[model samples]
Target: MREISFSVQALTAGYGNIPVVRDVTFTLPKGTILTLIGPNGAGKSTILRTISGQLSVLSGTVMICGKALSGLSPAALAREMSLLLTDRVRPEMMTCFEVAAMGRYPYTGRFGRLTAGDRQIVRSALARVHADDLAEQDFLAVSDGQRQRVLLARALAQEPKILILDEPTSYLDIRQKIELLSILLEEARERQLTIVMSLHEIDLAEKVSDLVMGIRDSCVFCSGTPEEIFAGDTIRHLYGIQEGTFLTRTGSIELPRTRGNSRIFVVGGAGFGLPFYRALTRKRIPFSAGILFENDLEYGTALSLAVRVHSVPAFARTMETAFGEAEKDLLACQAVLDAGTRIGETNAANARLLASARSAGIPVWRTIHEQD
Candidate 1:
């Protein structure tokens, strides 16, 4: 088994003698990636600040490598852990290189001068984050995305055993978010670095976390593997999400289906119906979709956005009874939409539905844009 990196026991933490988070606890092994998730003001940042030794622990204990958090000196703590928080660092006269090199201060001598070895590590860190080009530029003048990468580089240059981040992906674009998280994963895998962070992007959190802890009501509400935490309305309840539901299979979110009048019958399956469903939802056009296999890629979205979905077991044949029901619904609808689902030998019933719609003089739209 890997060594335990950090342990929190019955910790009550906040600023200035008041506790914002109470009785939080977890143990992470070396190389473990743990994510804290919840709605805003759930004390995730407070918990992170306390464990990282930036804020005082109101009660209980925090241990890093078997050493008490309060017992470790500033230099000792810096050597053991690094942070990239929402807080901005504006170094007036420092270049990005100098700001990044500050991460080596834990190892620097009394005068805080960097040797050739330290400079090399700093450069390598900048390159790892693809910010080497900005090394000569002033830290304060870079864009937020570039600044985020530089801060990450600084944290990496620290080469600490544990990293604490709060909303580390803030101000990052989609591509930057992917690259930064991928780099963190690589670091954790190759260097045995333990990570504890809070992310608003639960989808990315679900993908990257080894252990997920849900923080709410000023305490640790749920802590388990990502599978356990993300399974079945747990996140919905965790965040009190009323607008849309969380999709477990794909780790995505979908807006609620409209219940207004003028329903449209849709024939969709095999991932072909996603855009049509979203477009309908965006237009506030209520729809009933059907004939999807339970394992279809868009099944979750269909479930969330469709007023009533007709589905069959994955790999099972579409029976005549289902076809009869769908045809009835189709004829009763104002129109039918064909999401361009292929009519294979198994799902050829959908083709009959389309034919039935045309027979009844109901509009058979080959594309949703026809109605648009």
Candidate 2:
């Protein structure tokens, strides 16, 4: 059996005696990444704080490598784990390099001085996070993204078996978030390090994590692999989303489809109609979409943004029954918007729908706003 790197059993934690999160339990194998996701104020940070030993546990236990966390000395725990928290730190006159070198403290001599080897590790950590260029800059002067990278580097400098991050992607842009998560994924695979982090971007968490836990109302709401957790309306229920639709396949959310009768018909396929669908919904113009295979990438988006959609079996030829139904809807609309999806063998039904629209004297538009 694989060894468990970290395990929490029925843990409850919060400031003082009041518990914010309770009955949280999970076990992660070495080198696996576990992500915690929930609505705001759901105690994700409290769970992390308890596991890191910064907050007192009200009940239950956290074990690191088969040893109880409470029994471990501070120095010993530092050797086993490193934390990148959400708290902002403004260090006066401290260079980024100096900030990163602090991770070596647990291994340093009595003077807390960095030797040549320690300096090399700090530099390597900075480079690993693409922050080596910021090494000599004032830590407080850098951008939020840069500060996040430097903080991650500091955690890496510790060379611990487990890394704990609290919303590490908070200040990062899309590119920076992807880059940071990529580095963590590589490190986990190559170094056999365990990772536990909280993420606001459930989409990214689904893509990156080996295990995902959903927290709500002070307890573990759900825990499973992303595939298991993301199935059906689990995410929607988890977030209490009522006004919009959540796409499990793409991890994208779309506004509710415009209500009432659809005035416009869309001939969309091959994922080409997504933007048009969204635009129409925003304009509060009810629209119908058609000729999409059930497995088409745009199928989910259409379901979310269109009043009605006509779909056929994936990989199967467009059925005449489906086409006839779409033609009926198209004739009722004032205009037909062609998403300009590539015409291919499987999606030839879309082309036929366009021809039918033209034959019926309905204006055809390539863009949503071009409609008469």
Candidate 3:
């Protein structure tokens, strides 16, 4: 069997004799990433704190490298793990390099001064996170994104087997978030690092995690591979989503579609329809989409944004034989958008829609917009 780099068995974590999270059990092999996801106050951070040895575990055991976390000496554990939490740190005018070198505390001498080798490690860690340029600058002077990278470099400087992070993407822009996660993923693959972290971005979590755990009501609601855990109504139920819905295809949340006359009929397929759907939504235009194969990339978006979606089984030649509803929808709309979907053997019916619109004197445009 592959060696388990980290494992938790029935871990219950909280403060002052009260349990905030309980019965959470999971194991991660080397180079694996595990992410915790839940609504706010769902105890994700609490669990991370306990396992990282910041907060005491109320019950159960956390094992690092086949030995219990409690049994390992502080220096031994420090050598095996690096942790980054969300708690604010106000470094008093410290240089970024000095901040990163703190990670070498486990190896530093009794005087707590960094040696030449330690300084070299710190410099390399800063460079690894692309923040070596900021090494001489005041930690407080950099942007939030740069500070976040520096902090990650501090964690990397530990050169540990496992890493623990809480909401690592906070205070980062969309592009920065992508870069950080991409770097972490590459580091995991290259270094055989075990990772545990919490993420509010379900889309990124789905894309990045080797395993996923959903927390709710003080316990684990479900745990599995991203495929198994994100199926059906799992995410919707996990976060008690009411105002919006979790979309499995996009791995994101979408608000309810506008309610009004579906005055526009869209002929969309493949991925051509996605932006059009969102554009219509942004304009608050009520629209219906149809004739999409169930497996098309935009079908899920259509279902979320369109009032009445006319669909058929994937890859079926239903366009030739079962064009009743689409024809009916075409007649009721004020305009038709082609979405410029390609004509093919399976979806030749869309051409018929365009032809029918022109014949009926209903305006058909390759694109659409709300009149200003």
For residues 303-371, what per-residue lDDT tens digits would candidate 3 score against the true structure?
988988888888786665548878988888999988877778889888898899899999988853332
Alpha-carbon runs more than 4 Å astray in model 1: 368-372
Comparing 1 with 2 on TM-score, the higher-scoring candidate is 1
Model 3: which residue pairs collide?
A: none
Give the alpha carbon lDDT tens digit for every residue of 1-372 in model 2. 678999999998999999999899999999999999999999999999999999988999999999999999999999999999999989999999999999998999999999999999999999999999999999999999899899999999999999999999997899989998999998899889899999999999999999999998888889999999999988998988898988998999788778988899888776678888888988999999987889988999998888889998887865465988888888999999988777777777778888988998999988533322
Arranged by lDDT with the best first, the candidates are 2, 1, 3
| Residue 29 displacement (Å), model 2 | 1.4
Q: Write one digit per residue (lDDT tens) for candidate 1, span 233-321.
A: 88998999898888987988888788865379888887889998999999999888877778888888998998877777887776355
Q: What is the C-alpha RMSD of each candidate to the true structure, in Å?
A: 2.4, 2.6, 3.0
Identify the superior model by TM-score, candidate 2 or candidate 3: 2
Compared with the true structure, all predictions reach lDDT values of 0.89, 0.91, 0.89
Q: Choose the strongest candidate by TM-score.
A: 1
Candidate 3: deviation at residue 333, Å?
2.1
